[model samples]
Every structure is written in C-alpha cells, then in structure tokens.
Target: MSELTAFLSSNVVFGVWGGLVGLSLLVLAVDLHQKNAHLSPMMKFVWALTVLYSGPIGLGIYFYAGRKEIAHDSIWRRGFRSVAHCYSGCGMGEVLGVILTVGLLSLGNLWVALASFSLAYVFGFGLTMGPLMQEGETFSDAFNDALYSETPSITVMEVVAIGADLLLAGSAHMGQTLFWGALIFSLSLGLFAAYPVNVLLIKWGVKEGMMNPKHTPGNAAPQTA
Candidate 1:
C-alpha cells in the first residue's frame, strides 16, 4: 500500500497525465454538445464520463471507434459502447457511494462495499431505463427492461470494483488525493471486467449494442444481436 501511495504521489508525472486527461474530457464534452447534438443525451454523457477516468485512451477510442461515420460498427465496437454506457452510470454511483460511506461516514469496508453496490444498481438501472422511457414506454416496462439488461454487467463491475478496492487498500478519506486515485483505478478495473459481460448481453439480445444518431425516441441504430 505504501508503495502504491508513493507511486501515486509522483506529482510531476501524475500532474502531466492528469492535465492531458482533463483536457481530453473538456474537449470531448464540448464536441458532444456543439457538434453531436443529434446523439442521445445519455451517449454524450457516457463519452464524456468515460474520458474522465480512462483519460487519453478513452479519448483515442472515442475518436477511432465511437464515431458514426463508419455507418455500421462491428460487434466489438458496439459492445464497447454498451460497456461505456454501463460504466458511466455504475462507476459514478460507486464513486458516490464510496464518498458517502467511506469518506464521510467512515464506515467499514463491508458496509462501504454494500452501499456502493446498492447505489451502483440504482444508477445503472436509472440510466438504462431513461432512453426507453423517452421512447414512450411505461415505467413498469422500462423498469423490466433495465432490470434484465443492466443487472449482470452492473453486478460484474461492482464485484470487480470491490475486489480492486480491497486489493489496493484504497479506502482513504475523501479529502485525500489517494481516495480519488484509488477509486479511479478500481473503477477502471471494474469497467474492463464488465466488458465481456456486455458483449455477451449484446450477443444474447439482452442489451442493445448500437450507436447511431438519435433520429427517433429510442436508439435509432439497429441492435447487433
């Protein structure tokens, strides 16, 4: 843990990397708002939030893999978009749960993990249901869709995040830089862990994997499944 702490404390290197990430996030967010207004709000939010943690790599992927110019994306690209969508909501909720439980409340690891999982499910389901609701689906129907589509990926992400947190011993106070660093690292691992689950979900027709401009209420792109 001490070694990890020392590594993260390398201010010169971390500062440069952090600056690049911050710039990438800002550029992506602005581009989404100004140029990609036809995209669903959720997707715009996903790309920006993905860049927030994944940094330049996320930025590169967004430019190379997420653009709509290709017209028909491969299954892998579609799967990545699904995972990014899931990660945006689940990751944010997990971070908030950690802040509330561990940072503010100073709870034990088990309680923190539980609270994080609970919040992750809440955000994950809410994000998934939002687009369906926009398409005039009833609340119950949207809820069912979200439950079926989001549960497995969110579960895998939360489990991986918890494991990463434990392995890294990253339950520091919120005021500390280590807190954010640890959360970022753990959540990134969670994102990677959930990717295969999302691909499977796409393959099984349990989740939509298309990414296209929003010409209609729901996603306009065809589902890969």
Candidate 2:
C-alpha cells in the first residue's frame, strides 16, 4: 500500500504527460477502427504497437519493411518500404545522439535531444537518398524524394518525442530511473499522437513498402505486399 502511494505521489509530471498519452490512446482507438478491414489482426497489432512504441519512424518502417501484404505492386507496400528506409537512417542518427548524450560525452539532456533530433532527420534524408542513388537516381532527384517524403513523419515524431522528454525530465538528473521511464512513456505518447497522420499518408497512395532493399545493383528489390 505504501509502495503504491509512493508511486502515485512521486511522478506529478509523469501524471500530467500521461493524461496526454491517454488522449492519444483515445485518438488511436478511433482512427484505427475503420482501418481494420485493410489489415490483418496480427498486422493491426503490429501497427498499433509500432505507434505505441516508436511513432512515425515505426509507422514508416511498418510500410517500408512490409509488415503486411496489400497486393502485388500495391502502392501501400511501396510507400511503407520508402518510409521504413528513411527510418533506418533516423535510427542511425538516434544511435549517434545516444552516444553523444550518455555514452561518449554525457553532454546532458539538452544537447542529447538537440543532437538526436537534428541527426535523426539529417540521416533520414541521407539514407533514403543513398539507396536511390545506387538505383540510378541522381543527387537532385534523390534529394527531392527524401525531403518531400520524410519531412512530415519525422517532424511529427521529433516534436512529440522531444517535448515529452523535456516536460518529464524538467530539471531532473539523468541517472535516475524516473527520468528514463518518463522518456519512454513520453515516446509512447508521441507514437499515439502520430499514428493518424501516418494513416493518412498511407491512404493518400503517396508512399510504399518493399520486402527488403537489395543493396546490390541488378538485384530486384522484391515487393512484400
């Protein structure tokens, strides 16, 4: 009983952020309602969980990596693959940010977030362009594609994720579990907030997913859906 009291009383900020999270969850429940016909039970769970965990990046990856089959050469699959590819780059950038934040330099929370956000988008665009270049896309053409496609999703993700971290942490030191837990929890909220926007992107037929990107030239990148 005392433990429960400690838990409830300690995280006042967490509770506030959690209210926002709850709102996102409500939004997700409604938005995903009609999407049920379009995806399998498992795929639906995958999509929901991805949103629950990683927000835009995970949503893009779901399409990019071909989590579900829409049809052969379906726009849905192609779009997902494209988004996933961008997320791959973002993932790399976030890794570097983590290194800067706590691993290599311990530059504190502010620098860590700034580094992560800036690097994530930068790497997201670059990574997308890299594969397109190998596929015979020129720098100009690839640049346009990367910038246009990834901007919306990545922006949504970074804003929400960063906002959550700062709100939860405030002035707290990084070594504490509460700080870390709040960050994770805040990300889940971010995912919830971003899920609907991703769904709209998928619906617009402007995106696609592939089973895998065969890094080598002359190898056909197989379509998963």
Candidate 3:
C-alpha cells in the first residue's frame, strides 16, 4: 500500500489520467447500456472496454462510428467492427494474464509472454463461440467456427501487444507509469494491427462483422443499401 502511494505521488500525471479514464468508462458504459441497447452483448462490452482504455478518444469514436446505424456494412466499417469485437476479448485476456503472471507472480519473460498469449486465445475463442452456443449450436460446431474465424485476428493482436509490452516495459514494475502507458500504446497498436487482418477475413467471408442484436446465426437478415 505504501509503495502504491509512493508510485501515485510520483506519477501525478498518470494518476490524474487514470482517474479520467475511469470516469470515461463509467459514462460510456451507461450510455451504451441505456441508449445503444441494439448492440449485441459482446459489442456493448467491447465498446465499454475500448472507452475504458482510450478515454475521450474512444468515446468519440463510439459516437462517430459505433452508434450510427448502418443499413449496409461497408468493408471498412465491417472491418472496424470486426477488429473491435476481437480486441474486446483478446485485450482483456492479455491484460489479465500479464497482470497475473508478470505483475503478481513475477514470472520470467518467456513464461509471461506465453501465459498472455494462451489467455488471449482462450478468451478470444470463447467470445466467438459463446454466442453461437447460446443460440443452440453444439460445442464442437461452435468451437470449430470460433477457431476458424477468430484465430488470425487474435494471433495478430497478441503478437503486437506482447511484443510491444516486452520492448517498452520489460523491466518496469506494475505500478510504474511506463507499464500502463506502454500497455495503452501497445493495445492501440494491436487494434490497428488486427484491423487489416479482420478486413481481409471479412473480404474472404471467413468471419462476420459486428452483428446487430437482432441477428441470429441461422436466420441472419441481409443488409440493405
């Protein structure tokens, strides 16, 4: 506790910034739940998490791109949504894994990276499969779909995020501003890195983009221009 106090006192800028981020997340989460109820549960969580990390910029993006209703999902828009969806799960897993393995357990670098990657895959695949299973698909079928659809994006995201973390904060303690700052930068880069891959996947019909809440797997409605 005293160490945390010392860290925060020394990093006043980061402390203030973290406070603002927490406030932004609260606002975004409420707005999403109350006004954007049309979004899927997964999407709502994604948007909230995005805002939590990116703060005002993320909130602006949600208003500009996320809230608008698209009768036809352009390739670019579809790609953006796809990346956000994948990032939601992958980012959470990676951060948690790092916090647990690197921060808490103080594992070696290789072990920390492996643990982060493993958790990222698990959460990423689970998010993709969960909705399908909810809609009555067998576990085997849903797992296969998730494996095919999410693997590439998740892999790209994890590589960039973990690599950036290692490069930027390899020896920084968890309480250091460098650690969280590097994580935010790395996550943003990871999102961009996954975007093009997601676009390619959408182009190839390997995965679907951000789904409307009304969409069901078997009875998906066509988008209108």
Candidate 4:
C-alpha cells in the first residue's frame, strides 16, 4: 500500500501517463482531420479505438497500419503489420470488456479479467474474419483463418494487456484519471509484449495484414473507386 502510494505520488508517473494519453489523443485528432486518406466509416471507428488504447504508440500504429495501408512484402515488415491488425480488434474489445466488467458491472477483478479475455478474442476473431470474407472467401474459410490466426495473436495480447491492467487496478486508485491512465499504459505495454508473437505468426504465414481488405489480391481497391 505504501509503495503504491509512493509510486502514484511521484512526478514521473504523472508525466509518463499524461504524455502517453495526450499523444494518443493527438494521433487520433490527426487521423480524424486528415482529408486525403478518406477512410471508411468502419475504419474511422477502428482507428478511433486504436488511438484510444494505443496511447503514444497509437501514432505509429496509425502510420504503419492504417494510414500506410499495411503494405509490406518483406517478412519482418509484414510481422509488424500483422500485429497492428490484431491489435486493433483486441484493443477495442479489451477496453470495452474492462469497462463493462470492471466499471459498469462492478465485478471482482477475476471476473473482469475473464470478461476482458473473452471479449478480446471474440472481437479479434470477428475483425480478422471480416477482411477474408470480403475477399470473396467462404464463411468457413474465413472462420478457419480467424481461428488459426487471430486466436494466438489475441491471446498473447490479452494476457499481457490484462495482466498490466489488473496490476495497476490492484493498486487501489479510485480516481478516474488513474484508471484511464493505467488503461492507456496497458495498451502500450500490450503492443510491445505482443510484438514477438506476431512476428512469429507472420513468419509462419499464420496471419498478416488481413485487417486491410485491400491488401488481399483482387480486392486491392474500393468497389466504387
């Protein structure tokens, strides 16, 4: 208790959290105001959630993942793009689960964590499947792709993100600022932690850039454009 108190009271903690969250919002604003990209409504929503969870890293995620359209023929480059793909769905789902289970439902930490994990996986799989289906693939094909790809990708992310969230939440700060700060930090933490697993998955050809439906051959451009 005393250690937590000391940690929270430190200036470094405030600076780190504030900087990350502020950067996240700034990144989101840029994505919103940029006129040239002309993202779809669904993509706008997806990037919004990415910014919300990604914190400072949100800026780079937007750059490498969405704005640049996850274009990479190289194996290593594809790996990061794959992580970006998985991160979006997992980020959105985990945040909602955390808020629902911990914030609204007032459940215990155990329940909160469980809910976060479940929701993350569900959202992750759905988002991954969407692009495949849009590529004129069958439901079964998309489902199998999602199951094989997003499962491991999201699992690594959720475990790391939830672990960080629970750790910070357990510190007993009842303030809204502190809770949100922890969440933002957890998002950044999850990104770094999940990178290696994503790299392996990409290298093994399990998943890569499936979030950008355009990346799939024959669906490389919008239907109208």
Candidate 5:
C-alpha cells in the first residue's frame, strides 16, 4: 500500500512536468502557422494537444497534419520563400522564449514553473487574438513576434507569474489552487505583455504598407480602380 501511494505520487509529479513541457511545445508549434496561412485554428489546437498528451505519436501526427506543403513553380517561388522565411523566424523566436522562460521557472520551483508556463500560454492566446484583433496576424504570428522581439519582457513576466504561483502553491499546497492561480496570473501577465507588442506590430505593418484588412473569398485580392 505504501509503495502504491509512492508510485501514484511520483506519477502525479511527472505528469505535472510533462503537461508543462507539452503545452509549451504545442504553443510554439501553433505560433508557427501565421494567421493567413492555409491552416485552421482547430487543427492547431489538436496538434498542440496531441503533442502534449501523446509524445512520439503526437510528433507523427504533426508531420502528417501540421506540416505545410510548398509549391515549387517559379511564379509561386517568391511567395513561398516569403512564407517560409516568416515561419522560420517565428519558430526561432518561440523556441528561444519558451526555453528561457521554462529554464528560469524550473530553477525556482516545479509547480511554479508549470504554472508560469500555463499562464504564458493562456495569456498568449488571449492577447494575441482577443479584442484588439491587431490586424489579424493570427495567434501564431503574434505569439512568435512577441517571443522573438520581447524576450526580456516575456522572461520577466514569466518569472513574476512563477513567483506568484510559488507563493500560492506553498501556502495552500492544493492542486486546484495552484492550477487556478497559475492560470490567472499567466493570463493577466501574458495579456499585459502581449497587447502592446501586438499593437506595435500592427503599427509597423501599417507603416510598411503590408496591412491586409480583408480576406477575400478564394484568397484573391480584389482589383481596385
């Protein structure tokens, strides 16, 4: 009986860490698909969950379902190149951000680390796609841009959320409290950090004359007089 209890406890701890690692990877992957890309949000979500829960099986699913196909024809080469470049840049940014944040949190406390990560994700989703819309850069684009450009901000906010979670986790030592508190802190800080960066990106897009406000059917641009 004691052995069984110890095993269960160990599993719970492992599960918590696994969940955080999985979630961070999932968020990074989703952020790679730009808003206007030929992928659906639902599809991204499924991929994220798969990566989180299933490990190797999830990676196989990603290669099959999440990987984008590029056309090699000369006419489409430039566009494809642009898309590839954008995604690559986004991927690098997300990787760095997630690594730094997770590393710092891991050093402090495991629960706090996981909570910070969860909050980062929740807040990232809300800030990147919620109210502001910010010129429809997709959740992926916004997140990548934020991660890439605002590394310091992300690191700081994540640390703050982790610290807060640690305090709450220590006090209550209750699963529900830790989870909810982490979620709330992550969401709040994520929004606070992401919103301004999104706005800046929007402003930059507008200045660069790349702001596309409408998505015409069939993904075609309407002719103007």
Candidate 6:
C-alpha cells in the first residue's frame, strides 16, 4: 500500500492521464444512460469494457461507429443534414488565437496568454450555458441544463480546462524563471492539436443539428397515442 501510494504521488503525469481516462469513462456512462435505454445485457458489458479500457480514443471510436447504430433517430439524426453545413464559419479563429497566445507566452508575456485564455474560457463557458440562459431559470436549473444537455459544448470546455491544467503543470515541470515560457509553449501545442478535432465534433453536431436550441431534453420525450 505504501509503495502504491508513493508511486501514484510521484507520477503526476500518470495520475493526470488516469484522471482524464476516468473522466472519459464517466462521460460514456452519461451517454449510455441517455441513449442506451434498450441496450441488451451483453452490449452493456461490452460497453463497460470498451469505456474503461479504451479511454478517449475509444470514446471517439464508439461515438463515430458503434453508438450511431443503436442511437435513437430522435437523438442522433434529428437535426441537420451533413457535416459541412454544421462547421460553417468555424475555421481559423481558434487556430490563430492559440498561435498568438502561445507566441506571447514564449516571449515571457504571461499576461497576454492569461488574458487570452481567460477570454476563451469565458466565451466557451458562456456558449455552453447559452441554452439555460434562454429559459431564465435559477442557477441550479441553468447548471443542470448545462450539465445534461450540452455534451459537445461541455466537452469543448473540458478540453480547454485540461489545457489550462497542463499549462500550470508545465510551468512547475520547468524552472521558475522559464516556467511561463514553457507553459505558453505547451498550451499552444495542446490548443493547436485539439482545435481541429473540436472543429470536427462541432461540424458533426452541427451537421446533425445537435446544437439547435429547439432540441432540448424535454423535447426528447416519447409520444403517447
């Protein structure tokens, strides 16, 4: 037990990675609850194994391939027609923002990076909360709405949060004098790497009209004759 504790304490990278994997699994659980109400026992077992072991890559694959097959038409295909239509006007902004933020950080301009990160964080968070705002509910209602309905937007926010955490970690990993520089560089790379994938998911959701404001959870109720 002592050895195990020591190993985990010393290995921050592994711990962070494991946390990310765990989060992916948690999201998978939420997806299962939302979309797999009629899945067989065997399929549930397979899903458990896939989510626990395969991590984020597994989540991506299942979302693109397996989940679509069993997913309800109301949940999966209720919105738009194609990926292209969804991704319109989503290009270059994220890429350029990341580049400029990182460049400033590399030049020891931590303030600039912090400002940019803050703005991006606010924008993403607000977008994630937009639906709830429209309803004029209490804080709890808005929070719950954001949690349950905004999966893609929530995922994007998580990516940014993870990038921020990584930036802090990179600072500590490097010396104090160079910490900001290293953090900026690391965050830049992370943003660039993740932005394209996010754009793709956005497109997928948009093409599917998954982001449409009219498609709320209440709208997904089964009809009775």
Could you tell me how far off, in angstroms, the CA of residue 178 lies in candidate 3 after the best superposition?
A: 1.4
lDDT string for model 2 (1-225, tens) is 335323423567545645655655455455446332333343444445444445444544454444323334444454554444444455556546755676567677778788888998888787667767988999999989878767787777667766666666544445665555555555555444544555567677544433332232233346798
Total clashes, candidate 5? 2
Q: Rate the local accuracy (lDDT) of all candidates.
A: 0.79, 0.56, 0.78, 0.69, 0.40, 0.41
Candidate 5: regions farther than 4 A off: 1-153, 170-174, 201-213, 216-225
- Count clashing residue pairs per candidate: 0, 16, 0, 0, 2, 2
Q: Which should have the higher lDDT, number 2 or number 6?
A: 2
Best prediction by TM-score: 1
Runs in model 1 with CA error above 4 Å? 1-5, 33-35, 213-225
Model 4 over residues 1-225: C-alpha lDDT tens digits?
A: 447545645567877866776778776777556532455555666666666666566666666655535454455555665676677888878888888876777788888789889888888888877867987989999888888877876887888889877887644333555566667667767877787888788777776543443443333355593
Tens digit of per-residue lDDT, candidate 6, span 134-165: 65876777656544433353244335533553
Which ranking of candidates, highest lDDT first?
A: 1, 3, 4, 2, 6, 5
Tens-digit per-residue lDDT, 81-135, candidate 1: 8888888888888988888888778998888888999999998888888888998
In model 5, residue pairs whose N, Cα or C atoms come closer than 3 Å (at least 3 residues apart or on different chains), thus clashing, are: 31-140, 119-186
Compute each candidate's TM-score over C-alphas. 0.86, 0.53, 0.83, 0.74, 0.31, 0.28
lDDT of 4 at 127: 82
**What value does the lDDT take at residue 190 in candidate 6?**
39
lDDT for 116 in candidate 2 is 81
Measured on C-alpha atoms, candidate 3 has an lDDT of 0.78
In model 2, the worst 10-residue window by lDDT is 209-218
| Model 6, residue 36: C-alpha shift (Å) | 16
Displacement of residue 220 (Cα, Å) in model 3 is 18
**Model 4 residue 23 distance off true place after TM-score fit, in angstroms:** 5.6
Sorting all predicted structures by TM-score, with the top scorer first, yields 1, 3, 4, 2, 5, 6
